[model samples]
Target: MDAFYASVEQRDNPDLRGKPIAVGGLGGRGVIAAASYEARKFGVRSAMPSRVALRKCPTLLFVKPTFEKYKAVSNEINAIFHRYTSIVEPLSLDEAFLDVTYSKYEMQSATLIAQEIKNDIRNELSLIASAGVSYNKFLAKIASDQDKPDGLFVIPPEEGPTFIKQLPIEDFFGVGKVTAEKMKANNIFVGEDLLAYSKIELQQMFGKTGSFLYGIARGIDHRKVKATRIRKSVGAEQTFSENINDEISINEKFTQVFEKWWERYENHKLKGRTVTLKIRNFEFETITRSITETEYITNKSDVRQKLTDLMRESIVAGVPIRLIGVSISGFEIEETDTEVQQLTFW
Candidate 1:
């Protein structure tokens, strides 16, 4: 699924076809959930401020998100995946990983299976999906995203090393802006550069993450694709219109945000043992404090009290705050038991 939400809007409403559009809020403080490829040409992207996106592409049209519709389509696509292999690991509503290593079709070729899936999506759902076929998840994931819209790329075992070597360190999964900068500072700019360091040396620089990086740099990823993809956490955050320093005002905003978070948690029927309070100051420095209860959070009042206590202990009354967030984790949401087979799709 490419430009999922926006594409759905385009598919449903012919007027939006070929036009630059976005999905999410159109309000001043709203953020984009997805953007059409046409909008992407103008540098608009998902997670961007809707205002900033409008500034980038003045003709951009913002449509409200239709989660129900998206989920329906997701279910349809998941069913299609099940036709080939039950080892489908859904990453989100639009994408998943499948292990076709022992597919029911016994196509015996991941590349062919990928093409068939893409064709089925386009023919049946009137949508495009890109795929990557490779021996391991890491290489497969990178390959899937390498091409656009309706691509199907393959990374055979023989070519993995050369391909991985040329990839920029920043492009490796899990390397954020800060880590990328650190890698560059240490002359580890690409996969080959990363390969220069011994495992011990890389570990010294990146701690536990270094070991994972070393394996990927060598074109080795052994992680299995689990059919049941359990969500570990869910939360929400807000960036204030202006820096807040007053205690009463901060708590007021916290209460408002917590209400929104609680509504979502209940909607998902998720409970967790830990509640985390995240705070960022005017200078952009951020910190988090968390409290884990012996029992899972059972009520809004309990979470609110924990949030109140965490904020009180963390915040200096007059310290201007740029952002505040609340989150809960350490609970595994139950997953429907789908069967197992593996093939890769982006």
Candidate 2:
């Protein structure tokens, strides 16, 4: 999926094809959720402020995001992936990692499977996808982004170390701007530069992340592709059209937001021990407060009481509140027995 949300909009509307478009809110405080390749050419990007994006690309077209449609498309893409391998780890709505080591179709080469998946997506969905096939997740993820708009790239095991050594430090996964700047300050500009430092030195400088950096620099990522991921937290929030200062108004709005979130929580049948309250003031200062119970808060009354207590402790009197949210977390993992068969190479 390339420019997923924006591409979906373009696919559904012919007028938007080949035109610079963005998917997001068209408001003062709105942000760009996704930018089309045409928009990207003008330096527009996802998470950019709508105002800034418009300023950069005056001809940019803004379309409201349709998440339901995107999810439906994602489902279709996932179905295609399962046809190739059972070990599929979804990174997001638009991207996933498929371990085709023992593909259901009996394919031995992951590159061939990748090509077939790309072809299936294009032939069936009328959309373009970029794929990266490599021996591990880190290299594969990096390779995937090397090409854009229906591109494919592969890094065999023999080439992995050399390829990583040449990559810029900033291009490495998990190296954000802050971390990149820190690495640059220490004269670590490329993956090869990282090899100069001992594991102890990196760990001292970056804590747990340092250990990860040390391994990836040498193309040694031992992480497995998990077929399932745990749902960490479920929460909802609302940004008000206008700021509310009075306690009565705040409480009313909070209740409304809480009820809506609770309905969603109930639908999922999720149980959690922690209740969190999130508040954003008129000045955009955000604060969160959480309370963890000894046992799971399964019923509405128990959860509501916890949220109410958090609001009382967190909210500031007379301060205008622009947003309110509630969430539950600290879920207890349920164990179940399931088995997946895979071919063992002799």
Candidate 3:
């Protein structure tokens, strides 16, 4: 899936095709959820402020996000993956990792499997996808981004070390902006630079994360592609136009959030024993309070009572509340017909 939300909008609308379009909220504090490739050329990107995106591309078309449609497309792709392999690990609504080690088709070529998957997505879903074929997840993820829009890239086991050595430190898995800066300060700017240090030295410098970086630098990732991901929680939150301090307005917002949470919970057919209340104050302080009950919480009264108690403890007369969220966790999920059991080799 390429530029997922924006692409969906473009695919369904004739006028938006091959045009600069952004999909997200269109408010004063709105942010770009996704930007089309056409919009990217104008410096628009996801998570960028809408105002900033407009400044960069004045003619950019702003469309509200349609998550239901995205999820439907995601489910369609998941079904397609299950046709080839059961070992699928979804990274998000748009991307996933499929372990075709023991594919149902018994295909020996991972490259061919990737090609078929990309082709199916294009032909069936009216969408384009870029795929990366590699022996391990770390390398596969890096390879996927090597080419953009509609591309397929592969890294063979024998060529992985050499390929990784040439990559910059920022391109490494789990190396974010802050970590990249720290690596640059320590003169670790590329895989070759990172590999030059001893494992013990890296561990001493970066603690537990140093071990992870060291293994990936050497092109060693032992992680398996897990098939079934248990969703432990479902929650919803709302940001107010203005900070709220009164009890009536607070409860009203909680009721709205509860409706959303319940909708999601029922959709997943899940029940939980724990309820968590999250509060963000006008001063930007965030707080969470959770309680685990003997019986699974299933009704509005149970959730509202717990949330109200937590709010009472956090809300002050003068302090205004900026955000409120309610969540249910510590739940068990039963397997459904749609989910395929993951197969592991080793």
What's the CA error at residue 284 for candidate 2, in Å?
Answer: 6.0
Stretches of candidate 3 exceeding 4 Å from the true structure: 231-235, 242-346
Candidate 3 residue lDDT tens string, 1-346: 7898898899999999999999984875567889999999999999787788999999999998888999999999999999999899997888899999998999999999999999999999999999999999989989999998898999999999899899998998667787889989999888989888888999898876788778888888877888867665678888787788888998888788878877877776768888788888876677888998888777767667777788888777778987888788767653242222222110
Query: Model 1: what TM-score?
Result: 0.84
TM-score of each: 0.84, 0.80, 0.75
lDDT per residue for candidate 2 within 1-346, as digits (tens), equals: 7999998899999999999999994787677889999999999999787788989999999999988999999999999999999999887889888889899999888889999999998899888899999988899999999998788999999999999999999999767888899999999999999999999999999887888889988998877888986666678888776789888888899889888888877776758788788898877788989888888887787678767888888878888887898887766763231212121110
Please identify which of the two predictions, 1 or 3, would achieve the higher TM-score against the true structure. Answer: 1
Query: Judged by lDDT, which candidate is best?
Result: 2
The per-model lDDT (C-alpha) reads: 0.84, 0.85, 0.84
TM match of model 2 to true structure? 0.80
lDDT of 1 at 10: 94
RMSD of 3: 6.0
Best by TM-score: 1
Candidate 2 segments exceeding 4 Å error: 168-170, 175-189, 196-207, 243-249, 273-322, 334-346
Model 2 Cα shift for residue 35 (angstroms)? 1.6
Runs with alpha carbons beyond 4 Å of true place in candidate 1: 238-246, 259-274, 279-287, 291-306, 312-323, 331-346
